[model samples]
Target chain A: MAEVRLVDVEKRYGGFLALPKQSLTIEEGEFLVLLGPSGCGKTTTMRMIAGLEEITSGDILIGGERVNDKPPKDRDIAMVFQNYGLYPHMTVQQNIAYPLKLRGVDRKAREARVRETAEKVELGALLHRRPSELSGGQRQRVALARAIVRTPKIFLMDEPLSNLDAKLRVSMRAELKHLHHELGVTTVYVTHDQMEAMTLASRVAVMREGRIVQLDTPKKIYSEPADLFVAGFIGSPSMNLVEGHITGGRFEAPGVSIPVAAAERGDVVLGIRPEDLELTTAEAPPIRGKLYALELTGEATLVTLREGATSICARGPAEFEAEIDAACALAPRPGARIHLFDKTTGQRIAA
Target chain B: MRDRSLQYVLLVPAFVIVLATTFYPLAYSLTTAFRDWDLTRSRRPEGWVGFDNFAHAFTESHFLNSLWVTTIFVVTSVALTLVIAMSLALLLRRKGRMHTFTRVVLILPFAMSPALIGVSYRFMFNPEFGVLSNGLAAIFPWLEGTAWLADPELAMAILVLTDVWHWAPYMTFMCLGGLASIPRETEEAARIDGASNIRIFFGIILPQMKGVLLVTAILKTIFALKMFDQVVTLTGGGPGTSTETLAYFIFNVGFEWYDMGYASALAWILTAIMMTISIWYVRMLLSERKMATA
Candidate 1:
């Protein structure tokens, strides 16, 4: 419904800067997720957009209108908090109808909209129940219903589904994707879970201390990470990085060596995801070591190899079996890509 | 001894203390309320008067006057204190070093004894050479040298003011606790949901604060009914019993006039009032808890 733009936005707490000067544009009807670890300023950016936190510098525009001076109510945005933020005193019906009521909606229209929204979230039967009487997932649905009831110009979700159980989180993620598609609202979501960001965001803005490290589609981000941090942060069984050196067009660690396109280097970190490597019967020349640990993950087997001090893990077939200390060999699956990063700067090196 | 009996034994000291301090006086007073035991007329209790003393209270002008005064003081002081406390809590709940210092300073007024507060206000409200009286006169200009403690209405106002000043800070801390229990997200979500600040407070914050406010109002009501310390130290039931609360009336009836039977009856009446308020408070707490976990 509206484009949310942050032009050179910055946030500081006294002398400590929470978010450095930065700019970002969330296209209208796009789902942008700011993903990072705990102290990363992603939430700070979301709060600034919500008008909950004051921007230390620069402008924030929504729908081409500068909202830096406007109070949150004037910004015409709705948020679903991490805790759902349901009004505990009100029943689900009232909670969903609250936004309309604030705009002076009549009783009949309010009730009709409330019922329709409740049914959308599959919460019609629980409309008369208070938040205290609902389970965690049901409470999350109520929060979702509340935000979508009035169809504001923007939706700000601060890790809305992080509090649910593992199984419920997946289902809720799907529901959120569907909701975004249905509403077509410009949404800014903040979260630390990379998986959620990868699935739910049209573009994931991976943030570090105070700035976005990479702003790209999830597929592009996973395939071509901007740097060492992004390379190691995105994947499930994160990209394996073994430190040694790139000498004579080869990446060499303690017990591993790989052919690379990089020139001779003294020290570098070689990155490879577990899924990109294949386990073999100890006849390869790339990764040769003692089998450290083998884990069966239902669909695949994770085999870790250790020699002296370094360890590397590879995803093998589910039927793959090995003795704990027996010799192991792993090689890049024919067309897999390898990543090389400089040791000192933590920036990816050309390969 | 077994653990079961030891638990009972451990409670013995507390039970004895309660029996001696609370129940004993209550029992003695109930017995005295039914008898003509004027200390000036007899060394011990006189013949049983049945309902005479209790009935006399319904017709006694002074008793009725004290009841009316007490009602006025309780209603005004409790309402004012609750409003002031909740407002202070809201303002002081902001995140800042200055707000923290202000919250810490709010406890000082509540820490002072109510009797001490009364004495301080008495001195401060003096028409002559009093800082508050002269300062107010200076600000208004139309009024100068108005006798604050000598006028009935003004005296009652000062009494209520002293009580409110003494108690608002404590109630503010309670309100702070209640406010703290509400997640900040609720208010922020409301704001993002397009509700104005005033709307958020009245519709969201206040409704959630019902239990705390109710308990504060009832507790303050009981305290106001038993407001005797300030009456003694500040106004001395001054300006023709304008500030004479029920507790002070009972004290006067018993010690001042030596009307022991009537005083005992009056004390029972005050206790009954406090008990009724306490029962209501307990009921509210139960329902609030039920709503919380429903």
Candidate 2:
């Protein structure tokens, strides 16, 4: 396994900067995921590392060697494309054995390794079938098998599980985690799915508009988001961001009032996770609004409340029931972390 | 029942046109192939010939020469056209101002009529005053004053060249269409799998292009077998029947020699060859599809 380093890397498409200058070091054998929405340059970064895209400026070093001049074939890296990229004319056995064949491995040994890799991916039965005969999930397994078959120094996966159905994606995600654990190969995965990043990555790099906005472990990034964007992006039923001001040591808006450690400031935004808030019946709760929408989500109910211009969502018990436009109160659960950010800059306000 | 009857009524006009244009001629020819009908000797068929007309083809020296000539022409022209079209497709697949301009210019040759192409090449390869002849003589002194369309081999070579020029661009467009359908990810994946550029093309791109190439070869073969206009306009069945292709020979037998029964039999033979190739192509394509889905 090899560690990959991008030093002051910048990508420009005819003066339109696609990726701003940035440096990142992916530790050896670590599953680092670059996560962002579309047009965020996450794929661009991975392609550059795979030697598929030319770097406008900067050096990419893999395993401590500058490989900017090396072709992809010489870079000792295997990539699983988002579309699977299986050879339609070849059988699954040939597709998985291609890298070994390219390396001039003998026929007998190549067949053995291909079988072993196919069995690992549970594809032994379908080795004779072409990609057109396989299901979407099976095709994904073939792409994965091809990459791991050769045991390249690093593996680059560009949203490999995105094409599968939701249920298959979850199972495939678990398989990928297990594969990484078993192989211990340095992998750089690029995806727009936050849940995949949280589940599969050793560290997640949240990117926005060509820059790495936050690069941290999944738990740390979840608990302490770097700014307003991370706070809103990292959570399901996303964190409620109230645009208000801190006054008299309390953050206050039209329908919300909460104590904060920050000093008095006018343009402050309050960030709180939906899971951190509990439905309360107290006379004077920290958050008071009229119930707007209630959605049952199997294990919990999503309760949204609106007061004037401020809207908030909180996770309540599955049996929680309330009428629309009725008065609703919500208070922070004990030991729930409260986040504050500067409204003008979208920067976190340390307390 | 009324709608079904109306559908049949609607198809009647098309059926009549097809019968008048296609089926009638085909049936008339099939019968004519087995009869003795010399236009100069009789207005109607003179007598039944059985397999005599078809049998006469094997014994005729000129017919055998034309058959040999056609085989050479078809094989060489189809191979040359396929290679040139595939290379042009690869070169023009990428986007650029120059490539776009070249692609637009490439259509000119294909757009020209085959007869026109024949006429132009005949003029260009004229021994004394032709521009191509003069240009080649200037580049290579030994080529000066060479009778390009007089020699048997050179005449056949020029014939093949003209056909390739006329068809290669159209076939290149077909190849480009085939290339466009292949996903770019497969090539990138191959590169990452440590396959060289050449290996990726031969292993990945060329294999995927099998269906398209086969279709192109079959089409070129059919067109080559039926090649008549160029033979007439370029060399007029050559300087002593040296480049007399089968279609030109059939024309000679019917119109020049007034041997209608023999000409019909020879035309049927050419049709049989084309039909055989087409059937083979269809079978290959079906098997390829089966393998892909298996």
Candidate 3:
């Protein structure tokens, strides 16, 4: 396994800066995921680490050696492309055995290792079939098998599970986590799926535009978002952000009032998670609004309330029932963390 | 019933066109291949010749020589054109102003008529005042004053060169179409798998191009076997029947010698060769489709 370090790296396409200068160090044997929406430069960063894309400036060091000028073949890294990239004309056996053959491994050893890798990926029965004959999930397994077959110093996966169906993606995600645990190889995964990042990564780097906005463990990022973007982007239903101001030690807006720790401010945004709010019938609850919508999601119901210009969503019990446009009140559950942010700058206010 | 009759009426024009254009000549030739019909001796077919006209082909010295010449021309031209076309495709597939301009320019040779290409090459290879002849002599002094179309080997080589020049660009466009269908991710994956650029080409790209190359070779083979225009315009069966390809020989037998029966038999033989290759090509394509869908 190797540590991948990007030191003051920047990428520019002509006059447009694709990735601003940034430094990141992915620890050895760590599963670091670059998570963001499309056009966020997450894939660009992974490609640069794989030696597939040229870094416009600064240096990339793998295992403590500068790899700025090294070709991909000389970098001792194996990658699983988003499209699987399996050879369409080659049988599964040949596809998995290619890296071994290229490294000049003897024929007998190559066959043995290929079989072992195939069995690990549960592909032993389909070794003779070409990629065109396999389903998409099978093709993904073949791509994964090929990367792990050679045991390269680092593995780069560029959203390898994105093409599979939702059910298969979850199972494959588990398999990937198990494989990383078994192999202990440094892996850099890129995806726009927040759930995949939360489940698979040792640390998630949330990127926006061209910069790393937040890089932290999944739990820490979920509990304490760095700013308004992270607070909205990390959660499933997302944190409700109410634009209001702190006055008389209480955050207030039309049809809403909430006590806060922050001092009186003109423009403050309140951030609260859906799971942190509970249905309440208190005469003067912290949050009061009219029920707008309700969605049942098996285990829980997503309840949305709108008060004037402010809209908030909260997770209620699965059996919770209410009429639309009815008056509603929601109060924070005990020990629920309350977040505050500066409205103008979208920066987190010190609490 | 009215719609059925209308369907039949709609197909009548196509059937009549096929019968008049394709079947009539084919049936006429098949019957004439077994008969004795010399135009100078009789205006109509004289008698049944059985296999006599077909047998005459194996025994005639000129016919055998023409067969040998055709074999050489077809083999050399197809191989040379395929290699050059594939190389050009590889070079021109990438995007750039220079590559696009070269690709546009490459179509000029293929766009020219085969007869016109032969005429141009004949003029360029003229012994005394030809541009190519003098250019070669300037580069290599020993080649000065050489009679390019007079010598048997040089004449055949020039014939193959002109054919390759006419067809290679068209075949290069075919190869480019084939190259475009291949995904770029496979190559990038190969690169990360520790395969060098050369290894990736041989191991990944070339194998995927097998179907396209086979189609190009078979199509070129069919074209080469029927090569007649160049033979007439460039070499004209040459200094002494040295470059007398089979199609040219068949022309000589029917028009010059007025031996219709013999020429018909020879034409049938050429048709049989082309038919056999075409059937094999179709079968290969069908099997490839089956493998893909499997």
Candidate 4:
């Protein structure tokens, strides 16, 4: 419903800078998630957008209007906190009707809208129940209902599903994505979970140490991380990183060497995702290693192999068997997916 | 069988102590309240006056008057304490260096001994040299000849005000503990829901503090009901017994008048009143819990 733009936004607590001059633009009706680990200023960014935290420098523009001086209420934005923050004292109906009441909606109209919104979130039965009496998932639905009832221009959610259990978190994630699709409101979600960001966000902004390292589509950010940090951060089981030097167009370490993609011919750290390492039975393998351990995780068996003294994780089919200390062959497939980064600068080397 | 025997064996000493210290006195008091026994009389009771003592004490206008006074003081002071304390707790909850200083200064009065507070207020309301009267008269010439503790209205007012001053801070401290325990996200959620500050306080913070407020209210009620020390020190129930509380009235009857029989009956009446109030308070609290959780 509205495009949110941050122009050189910054936050500071005394001498400690929480956020250092960050800029971003979230398109209208786009689900853009700011993703990072803890203390990475993702929540601060969300709060600033919601008008909960004051900006130390620069302005926030919502729908092409400067909102730096506006209070949260005047900005017409709704936020769902990380804890789901349902008012425990009020029934679900009251919680969802609060914003409408603040806006001076008449009683009959407010009740009708609340009923409709409650039904949308599948909370029609729970409208009379206090938050304490509801389960985790129900409370999350109430939070969503509260946000939707207002029909605000932008929705700011700060890891709202983090408090739910793993199974509930997954289901709630799907529900939230569906809700965003149905409502089509510009949403800025903050989460430390990369998988949530990857699945729910149209565009994901990866942050580290108060600065955004990469901002792009989920697939682009995951397949092509901006640097050593993003490469290590985005994937589960993490990408395999090895300290190797590029010499004579061949990347080499102790007991492991693979041909680089032509341009990265110098000392560079080699990065490959766990899924990118292909295991083959060819006699003259491009690289050879010995399996150190194997973990059977339902769908696939994760193999940890050691090339000389370095350890790398690789995902193989469930039927694949590689015992500890078994001989194995390794190769980085021919593509630009194999990332090379400068060892000193941590910057990705252009292929 | 062995477990039951072991439990009974462990309970024998505690049971004996309870019988000796608690039920024995209660039985003795019941028995003695029916008699006209005193120190002057022999150890053995001579006669049973059966309800005559109860009749005598109930008929005494002084005892009835003091009972009414105690009720007024208790209800007013306790209600005032809760209102003022909850307000102060909410005001000081957010973090700051100034908040810390204010908290320490506020809690200082509650930390002082009750007897000392009584003595200090006595000097403060003294007619000639008291800073309170001097300052009041200096600012308002209409109070030039006013001596607070001598006036019946002023004396009763001073007692109630001092009681609030000495105890409201303790309630504030407890309410602050309750406030701090409420999750910050819940409050933030309410704010984002567009509830105004007053609405949020009444609807969210106040209800969440119900348990702590109930307990503190009971305590303040008890303290005010036994309002003796300050009353005795400040005016000694003077100005023709205008400020005579139930506790002071009993003391006056037993120690000053030396009417042991009448005093014993009055003591029993006071005990009955206190027991009834405590039972009612506890019942209301239980019902409140059921209402909230149900």
Candidate 5:
């Protein structure tokens, strides 16, 4: 296994920068995920690392050697595309053995390795079938098997599980994690799915507008987002922000005076996770707001509260005890969970 | 019942026209093939000859040699057309302004009239005023006085060459459509799998184009088999009967030599060969489809 590093790598398509001055280092055997919304340069970053895309500037070093000019095969990296690009013409056996054949591996050893890898992906029975004959999930297994059979130095997965159904996607996500743990190969996975990134990566690189906003463990990124973009992008239901003035160490709106840390004493974007909001009686003046609606999603219910013009969503227990249009108080969770970002720069304020 | 009567009324005129235009001539040819009739003794027929004319047509040196020439022309021209067309398709299949321009230029020849192309090539190989012959002779002294249409081999070479030049572009356009319809992700996947461009071309691109290529080969083969216009225009059965193809030989026997009985037998032979080849081509395509879908 080899660690893959990008030192100030940049990509531009005739002055339209796809990835601008991005740098990242993935440890050997680490599952580092590049997670962002669409058009965030995450896929471009993965493609650059896999040598599928050219690096316009800076060096990409794999296993401590500059691989900027190296071809994909010479770089010893295997990529599993989101489409599960199993060769439609070749049977599962041939598709899995393609890399081995390209590398000049012997037939006897190649077949043995394919068998072993196919078993790892639970595809032994389907080897004789072509890709078109296989199911969606089976095609994904074949794609994974093709990438892993050669035991390349690094595995670059560009949302490999995205093509599978929701149920299969989750199962394959777990399987990919288990496989990565078992093989201990450095893997760089790119996905727009925040949950997939949270579940799979040792370090998730959260990117925005061609630059990385934060690159840290999933827990760290979620708990302490570096900027408004990271705070808004990482979590489900997304972090809700109140655009109010931080007057007298407390944010003030038309009908609200919510608590803010003493340091953030200006116009700021007061951020709160959906689960961070606590519902209280209307009589109590803890940022009073009318309950707009409640949406139940099995595990949790999203409670939308309106204080004047702004609407804030709060996640309560599945059976939320609140009525629509009922006046309720919202108290932001105290301490580190409450994020305050400068409205002008959108950067997190020091507390 | 009224709708059925109306449909029958509409079809009756078309049916009469079809029989008079198509079937009557076909039946007359079959009847003539079995009789002894010629322009010299022109009646419907004198008596039944049955297989006598067939045996004579097969044994005739001129007819057999023309059959060989036609086979050579069809096989060589169709094979060369597919090869050149597929290459042109691949070369211009890339998505760009220049590739689009090249594609348009390549298909322009297919729109030109075949007779016009034959007439043009006739003048181009005139050996005296022909630019091609003059250029070739200037470059190589051996071709200074060579009349390309005078020699039978050279005449047949020019025929196959002109046929390929005119029709290969049509095949190229067909194969281009086939190639363009393939998913771009497939090639990207192959490239990421570390297959070189050459490997991708043979293993991935060519195999995918097989269906369209097969259709191109069959259509070109059928057209090439009836090689007449270029032969009649360029060589006129040439120095001897050496350059006469099966179609030209049939025309010679029926219209020029006035040997209708022999020409009808020759027509039947050509039709039988064409039917066999077509059946084989279709069977091969069906098997390929089964394999791809396997």
Candidate 6:
């Protein structure tokens, strides 16, 4: 395995900048997940490291040797594309063995390695079948097998689980975690799925508009987002962001008021996670609004409340029941953290 | 009318045209191929000659020579066209201003009339004051006065060249369509797998292009087997009968020699060859579909 480093990398197509100058270092055997929305330059960053795309200005070093000028083949890296990229004309075994074959491995050894890789991916029976005959999940395994067949210095996976069904993606994600544990190759994985990054990454690099917005361990980043964009992005049902203000050590908006230790600012956005908010029938909770909707999600009921133009969703107990348009009080659960940010700049404000 | 009847009614004009233009001539040719008819002798056909014209074809040296020439031309031209067309297609597949312009210009070669292409090549290869001939002679002093059309091999080579130039552009478009269907990720995966550009093309891209290449080869082969316009316009059966293809020989047999019966038999043979090739093409397509499902 090898450590990968990108120094002052910049990418531009004509005059359009795809990636601004940025630097990152992925230590040996680290599974660094690049997480962002589409067109956020997450895939572009990984491709530049893989040498599949040309960096407008940068130095990419794998194992301390600059690979910026090297072609993908010479970079000693393997990539699994989102579509799997399995060769339709070849059997699964042949597809996995292609890397070893190109390196001039003999038939006897190639077959042995192919067999071992096939079995590792639970694809022994399907080795003789072409990609056309395989299901989506099975095809994804073939792509994984192809990347892991040979011992490359690094592995690049571009949303490899994105093509599989929801259930299949969960199972394959576990498989990938297991594979990385066993092989420990320095891997750069690109995906927009927060759960994948949270579960699989040693560190998550959340990107936005060609820049790394936050880079930290998943748990730390999830609990302590650097900015408003990240706090709103990382959670499901999304974090409830209410545009309010802080005046006289109290945060206030329409039908809501919260005592927070912050300087008086007319334009401030309050951020609270759904799970962190508690729905109550008390007279004056920190958040008060008319019930907009109630949705039962198996274990819990998500109570959505609206005050004027702003909507807030609070995850309440599963047994909780309420009607739409009823006045509801939502208080931050005891000791639950409330995040504040400057509304205009979207930067986190100390609270 | 009901929709079903309306569909059939709409096809009436095309059906009548096919029957009058295609089936009638086909039936007349089949009957005449078995009869003795010399247009110089009489306007009407004579008594039945039952395989006599077919037998004469096998024994006739002119017919045998034309068959040999046609085989050489078809084999050379088809192989050359496929290679050049596929290469051009690959080159043009990349997106750039120049590449787009080149792809548009590619149609010019295929769009020109075959007869006109022949006439142009003939003039271009003329030993006296021809641009290409004089240019080559100027570059190489040893080729000061070489006669390009007079030599049997050179004349046949020129015929194949003109045919390849005329057809490669059409086949190149076919190859481009095939190339587009292949996912870009597959080639990218190959590159990451340590395969060079050459290996990716031959190992990945070429294997996927099999169906398109087969179709192109069959079409070009059929076109080559019946080549006549270029031979007539360029060499006029030249210095000898060296450039005369099978279709050209059939024209000579029926028109110049007034041997209509034999010409009809030869035309039937060519049609049989084409029919057999078309059947093979269909079989290949079926197998390709089967492979896809499998």
Candidates 2 and 6: which is better by DockQ? 6
Model 1: which docking level applies? medium
Give the per-residue lDDT digits (tens) of candidate 1, residues A6-104: 999889899998999989999999999999998899988999998999999999999999999999988989898999999999999999999999889
Best by TM-score: 2
Candidate 2 runs further than 4 Å off: B1-7
- For candidate 4 chain A, which ten residues in a row score worst on lDDT? A258-267
Writing each residue's lDDT as its tens digit, candidate 3 over B158-237 gives: 99999999999999999999899888899999988888878888889888887888889889999999999999999998
Please give me the DockQ of candidate 5 compared with the native complex.
0.49
Positional deviation of B106 in candidate 5, in angstroms? Answer: 1.3
**What's model 4's interface RMSD, roughly to a tenth of an angstrom?**
2.1
Per-residue lDDT tens digits of candidate 1, residues B78-195? 9999999999999978777797678778889888988898888988888888899989999998769799999999999999999898999999999999999898999998988788
Candidate 6 structure quality by residue, lDDT tens digits, B1-294: 599999999999999999999999999989999999999998988899999999999998988999899889989999999999999999889888797688778899988989998899989999997887899899998988889999999999888999998999999999999999999999999998888888999999998898888888888888888898988899998768898889999999999999999999999988988899889987997798677667
Docking class of 5: medium
RMSD after CA superposition, every candidate? 1.8, 1.4, 2.0, 2.5, 2.6, 1.6
> Global CA lDDT of candidate 4, please?
0.85
lDDT of all predictions, in order shown? 0.91, 0.93, 0.93, 0.85, 0.85, 0.91
Mind giving the per-residue lDDT tens digits that candidate 5 earns over B1-294? 999999999999999999999999888888889888888878667678979999997678888899888888998999899999888888777677687678678878888877778889989998899988898999998989898988888988888999999998888889888998776656766776778889888877777777888888889999998988888877787858777899999998999889888788889889998899999999999987876776
Ranking by TM-score: 2, 6, 1, 3, 4, 5
Which regions of candidate 3 fall more than 4 Å away from where they truly are? Answer: B1-4
DockQ of each: 0.77, 0.75, 0.69, 0.55, 0.49, 0.80
**Which of the two, 3 or 6, has more TM-score?**
6
**lDDT tens digits, residue span B156-178, model 4:** 88888889999989889999998
By DockQ, who's the top model here? 6
Off by over 4 Å in 1: A282-284, B2-18
Model 4 misses residue A60 by how many Å?
1.4
Q: Which candidate, 4 or 5, would have the higher TM-score against the true structure?
A: 4
Candidate 4 vs candidate 6: the TM-score winner is 6
